[model samples]
Target chain A: MAISEPIVLPHATDEVRLARTWAQPRGFWGWFMNVHHTAIGVRFMVTSFIFFLLGGVLAAMIRLQLSRPENHAIGPDLYNQIFTIHGSTMIFLFAVPMMFQGFGVYVVPLICGTRNIAFPRLNAFSYYIYVVGGLLLWVGLFLKTGADAGWFAYTPLSGPQFTPGKRSDFWAQMITFTEVSALGVAICLATTILRQRAPGMTLNRMPIILWEKLVLSFMVIFAMPAVMVVSSMLLMDRTINTQFFNPANGGDVLLYQHLFWFFGHPEVYIIFLPGAAIVSTLVPVFARRHIFGHLAIVTSVVATGFLGFGVWVHHMFATGIPQMSASFFTAATLMIVLPTAVQFYCWIATIWNGRLQMKLPMLWVFGFFFVFLIGGLSGVMLASVPVDWQVHDTFFVVAHFHYVLIGGALFPMFAGLYYWVPKITGRMMNDLLGKVHFWLFFIGFNMTFFTMHFLGLRGMPRRVYTYPPEMHWGGLNMLASVGALFMAAGLIVFIVNFFQSKARGTLAGPNPWAAGSLEWATSSPPPDYNFTELFTVNGREPLWDNAPNQPIVSGVRDDIPEVLITNSLDSEPQHKDEMPGASIWPFLTSITVSIAFIWSIFSPWGIAYGAIPVVITLIGWLWPRGHSPAPRQPALEGRWSK
Target chain B: MAELEHTVRKGEAPALIWWCMFGGPFAWACDLGFSYVLEQHTCSTGHHYVLHVITVVCAIIALTGLAAGMAAYKRVPEEANDHGVRPMDRTHFQILFGMVFSIAFTIVIIAEAVPRWILHPCQ
Candidate 1:
């Protein structure tokens, strides 16, 4: 039955009329001002892609400089600032947001049988805050006050006395803005997963993606707070002369290290988990079966979140922390590999059992396995208290992280983008172009980062603005620079491919991937309310398992907007739960939050002044003065109505 | 709004409100219980016996208030189904389990703290 059909109801209620009246916006400007998750998600992807190109350009510059010892391709000051922003932008502003939150916000609720993200306004707020925060750092670079102390933005070096400008503040404030945005989305995403499973989709029945997000959300909750606390302290020290990291004021620099790494190490897992989620989603589809050891996989993800916090001290092996504590962290770090191994083994077993399609996404998965393995192994070596003290600040550490982050995160993000582009844009990205982009990127990435391990092994220290000649590292450095160009070329291809596909690409059907997730059950580029009918699940793959017998209750009028409440254990009708209608309050509230943060960065009084607008906006959001939502229609017809 | 007309019984509102009024003390007791345990491990100089006693009393009052709040919900048991137990049975178990765990954890904290408190008197 088409939703457009007009039905004469036996009795029409005010609720039905109200629901119909609240139908999603239709005009061009409505889309321009859209708060829908789909549009917001596209914004996140497009923005992150732009940053990716920017970060790639930075990567090429670093490679060119490092290609030869004593190379003056770019001066040390410029080189340091370039790499700092590149790493910070890629990790903080680009990869994690684009891969996890962007993908999670747009897809999780749709997959889990909810109308929207738990907090729609907060989601929108996060998007805008990210844009403004990202621009702040870029603007600094444009203004030639680029931060040069490295992405970590370590204390004393990054302190006001040394940095002498708002350079470190740019990095610190960006961290504050991005982490706050991430923490908000994490809470929103986590709460949605816990409370809003589709009926019949018990904890056991949840897709691994939801479980992965749940774990990652908790990680963000614990990990981001540490950064927020530390960065705020750093900001305070800079602006207000707080003694948090000031030795003259009896402060310890080690405190900053403790707090930062407390966030930093777990952040690696935070990024990796979402990639794991995407792989979990795609791997099972290609395998043509339920994921192997679903319960065990969820357990591993949860354990990894807990263990990620314990291993932060490994990043500080040379900081001269107590020997026992260092050993304990090393042991903890090594222990975390068990859970990661558990997930890896499960993926392998899943593929081994089922017919594997060597598609583009799958190819990236294979690449992740190879690249991430080497990275993980190197990381495990670093986790050893003894070995790490030797290579603590060398290029080896750089290689190890890049392998994991790039192999673990970037490869999977590309695969996921390609895998979901059809569903997101309602069009297929050109597979030939995608494959070409992948190979060039894959080859270029390896060429650039792989040789850094040897460079480090030969005692080439990292963060040196320039290296002296006769270091015997000129050849490898030059080779790295040449390799960076390939990466640049690949990024260019990806950019062209992305825009080209957006303008003209094959129209994708709802389930282009022939996968069984709920997001695929709806139209590609899903409707505002997401599902047409609220679906009840009988098994893991509802569309596949139930097929013609898919359980759907009918009788709801399409005119009334209503949310279905399913039985938590089994997807069954409970009641209609209507959410508050959209208001301009969230946007207004976020503006206040941003004002407070930006002001606080500049002046202490900014916090005092900013809190007023924040309180006002928050009150407006919580005060229920909106029109009563549309009435509940009969369950069956309503399921498919949205 | 009309459909949301279901309200508490005529005499129930005041009692429910009074029960809710005890929430502060209940919260205080839980806080003391957690802190008392931690203090027992960390503090070597002084024992906080009065604090522990006060915390336990508050926790008991809190538990009572919680029970009263639950009573206000006033659910009834219905017939059993093929699922093997009545829904009421599950509800009862949930309520019982929650109360038991809450009280038990509080008592466990007190139990450990009291022993340490006796052994190490206030300086």
Candidate 2:
């Protein structure tokens, strides 16, 4: 751990010179402002955790307010705002952002055999932009003007006439901000997976998480745009009087439903697949076997991404679209169940046939199986036109999503972080505390969401600030609220485990779990440029199969910036390419871009002016230096960018 | 270049190509078509024609892109085609070309069709 300590090298390659090039600074301020994927990823994880707790508190408030059916723990307006922000914060700010972007940004490059994410500067900007967007929403709440139009913020309700002032504007614009951040990261992630794999790391050989990120990035690109278009339109209708969603001036309320659900439906998968990816990565590692069906799992993920787009209309089953359209959406929704089932069976087969580790991460997987199964089954029920009509806007729908999103996504993300944190931080989280966290979250999640199904069957409508006591929904509401407290406690335990593990926990040696993935081939908290000598993998879990005789390289060059180019499909030798060392220009450029985005949100001309600084910075960033004809040749021939 | 020699085998390239083709410009086409159809008309005769025209253009673009991609594959060296193009060349140029033309076509059709869509906007 000391600065003068001898650094260990694991893999050696003769073709290229090996060296350490820390892209980030090591001091206190450097650590604070670090843009390295690992640092930024941890930042995303931590920030998301804080938001998750905040979102959880909002949930508690909602539960308490609803515990006794109009008992007035908070007023209707405040209750609406709390639940709205809670759902938004959890889904947008915490769950998908943290679980997918946070985890993916950190792990994907390492997993894919690269030193850094494709667009490190973009990665850093996304984190900061996300911060600003999150702050914008919370700041609105602190000012008592929190968005009260529900998380979906459906038109007419969220339209200018009904919900006046900057609350909805904050919500709409915040979505723009976050979606932009997500889209930027998506491009970077997608490109990284496509272009940055280690030599011999072919598409066929890619870890499942990379596949998920690749597919999800495309999904985010296409899906986020619809919402971005619609949200911008909504803002226009609110301020500029555009008739996009306003019925009176030829705008249809259904337009909002179409656009929002188009994004929203896939948004579930955007969150869901990453968690599934986590399970896919961890299951194989922990099972001590290659994934039972790698091709099958990756194919299923691709299929799910395609089928995901076709199913958005299912969310509008109650909208009274033509029965044919409804049926089509319903059928698409049911078809998605096929891919999910495929993955489920694959995981079961992997666990059933192989050695099960029974570790904390595995414990969460079991929880995921039980919880997500129920959620998926209930989702199938909603796919039925009749059953959907029965519980369309009720707590049953709410319960179904929570099961899928939290049970499906959040639990798996926690499993992933627990599984990979040691590899990331070189420290092991306390297992005892991890188990406790899992159980509390598992029991509490089921208790909270499961009861809501019954509450919905009893006819409790969702999105209402309060309900009458005579409605007989009080007991279940109270139970749900109590479960919220348990979830909160579990989250608290997780935070403590994270920080405690970092400074004082047991050191996680390289490959502590005896994992086989490429990431495990490197040292825990891997050095910059990832490998001392870039690895050429011949089989899955190459390190394990190759054994201790595996040649490991030592110090080559600590200075002179360079990149190892490899054959695109296989890790074959290519020319050494030099990469630019760290620069603050990307940081400054992103700040200017954010300013332009913020300004444009208020006034259109802000965008035009914002473009000026952006153009200058980008040109400066891309302008070639006169030192060398080419610093780094494309390693994989024309396969991947240098 | 030594780096570009690696490509995914023949089996894998299509899926990556399909995603880029539809996810980017194909989606963009739909959005453009929607705006064109809905912007100034209320489903009038001319409006229907405009919609049809735009749809045809998008289909042509998508189909052409697929065809061009297939054509591009043949032009790609056997080694490159078998593995997959440099993942960077994976852009849907056919779709990109179609998108550029379709937008131009949409504008022209709108200039012609909207007046008919309204029967008379001045009225």
Candidate 3:
């Protein structure tokens, strides 16, 4: 195949025009109306981090109350709300948003060498929806109407019979809000990766992060529906006198468990796979080598996504599911571990084979390996029916998940933030403070979660407001509480480091780490138009392999926000796509949707009345204006086409 | 015109490649759903052999996927030294991924089947 000569643009003039075309709106209105992926991505990260802090605070409260047996600091009622809200906030509000939506929206386009995400307005809409959902949950908590039926909200206990009121309703509706937002973002990202890559970035040449995001997107698409369905059924049963989980009326309680865990188990992978992606991405850069076993890693990620769906029943072994069925699920659960082990093996091999750089970010990756490995081992134990039966509804299960979630999600998240913050803020974070923060967090995390295994073995049950003083669980509980304080101090250090770095840290150039991926090819804190000129890569590590002579895409209109559409598989240029400018419709539409969702908790007819405004706002959003007509498709024989 | 022509010349991937990629997972999903639904029937009817039959059928489907992957892999020459920008490189990656999926799913299917022989459905 013959390569066409690259298109040369008037760099100075085009940069100004591109900036003008893609610049977000200014001032207060601009904040809501901005549709750029970067702004929305940053919002997702910051908002989720706030939720993480809130969840952490709740965690501290729980620890304090539990530090001594028969403590009366928090009563049973409040304790139930605290623990449930803590679990919900971390998983629903923090983990998926920070790991998947935040990172994917922020970085995927830049790496793909495109100007913006595929559906920028929809991306903005998802963020607003998420904010409204977070607000609803917290507001419910303050008003003393918070969900207390566990995060999973298993029925009969959560049903209208045992626990009546709007408590469980709030939890179910929050699930709807976050999952809708997640599903919307998943569509945007999958399309962006499939259709918006710069020409020459075929599927084979994509970075491992993109592959992981793509897999993550599909997992969200497939796995979220089950949760949404089950949650909706719970809401209906509570509000509309529906008997979806009312066994007296022919609805089985185990059905709810089956549906929730169906989504619930994949929900774990949905959270962790992005963390693994962060590790996969950072390992190659820190090791100063091309990633070892790229194909193997990609296969493992895809396999993990598939196997994730099969292992959900492992969470249901003690529910008295058929022995044969339980055995199948147990087998499936153990099988899922192989892919993760393969990933860990590949990362170790990469670090061992290459010149390893023990940077701040890499330090967190090491933390992940240690913490998440323990979590994974415990998880394998829980996979067996006999072990799960022994420790069911105990602190051991709680400890296993905390190690997995915190280690698998939080550690890699810190690594990713540290690795990319320079690119995001155009300044470097303080290494000395970062080291202090890491040590405090690592020691605190292990101290807090590790003791729970013993507590479980010694017969401490989970979700209990208080234990008898004679149980002798006081000393270890106090240690865990102290560890919580240490973790809090570590977070405060990080918060200080983040703001300080933003204000006065060392200026970092674009390629601070001389990373191989395309995101490093542009300036730090990239311009409004991410790349002044689009690039077509010749290899996976585009900057490393084809730097200085990478082929530039041309014919994309500079006066308007136009992106190139490429073939899904081979990424050959096909046409130009004009993007919508900043608009307030997505924001307004989200408000309308939020009203509908919130109002429905009070009356089922809220959806009917809500649909009218939602339709009106949606019409306003999609109504086309003559000023920004779609770009004319270029000839197939043009420079970009060839 | 040249790019469109090239795309046309390259053509769609063989049906086998798609099957190789998704077939094993699809089979496993079917096996899981079927055996789960059949568990109650087996418990009531005392026909535990039906679960084993489902597993065997699913395993055979997974093996078919594995075979398809192997055939595809043999057809596409190794591009070990080539930059992965070419169509052949993409095909090679997909085939390898499909092969791995097939192999993994087969093992999972067999693993799921083992308990059927040992544990009574009612137990």
TM-score for chain B considered on its own, for each of the candidates: 0.41, 0.38, 0.84
Error of 2 at A522 (Å): 2.2
- Candidates 1 and 3, the one with greater DockQ: 3
Chain A vs. true chain A, TM-score per model, equals: 0.92, 0.92, 0.98
Candidate 1 docking class: incorrect
Global lDDT of each model?
Answer: 0.71, 0.72, 0.89
Worst 10 residues of 2 chain A by lDDT: A1-10
Flag regions of model 2 displaced more than 4 Å: A1-20, A26-33, A546-558, A566-577, A609-630, A634-642, B1-123
Ranking under DockQ, best-scoring first?
Answer: 3, 2, 1
- Docking quality tier of model 3: medium
Scoring model 3 with DockQ, what do you get? 0.64
In angstroms, how far off is A595's CA in candidate 2? 2.8
Best of the candidates, DockQ: 3
Which candidate comes out best when scored by TM-score?
3
User: CA lDDT of A471 in candidate 3?
Assistant: 95
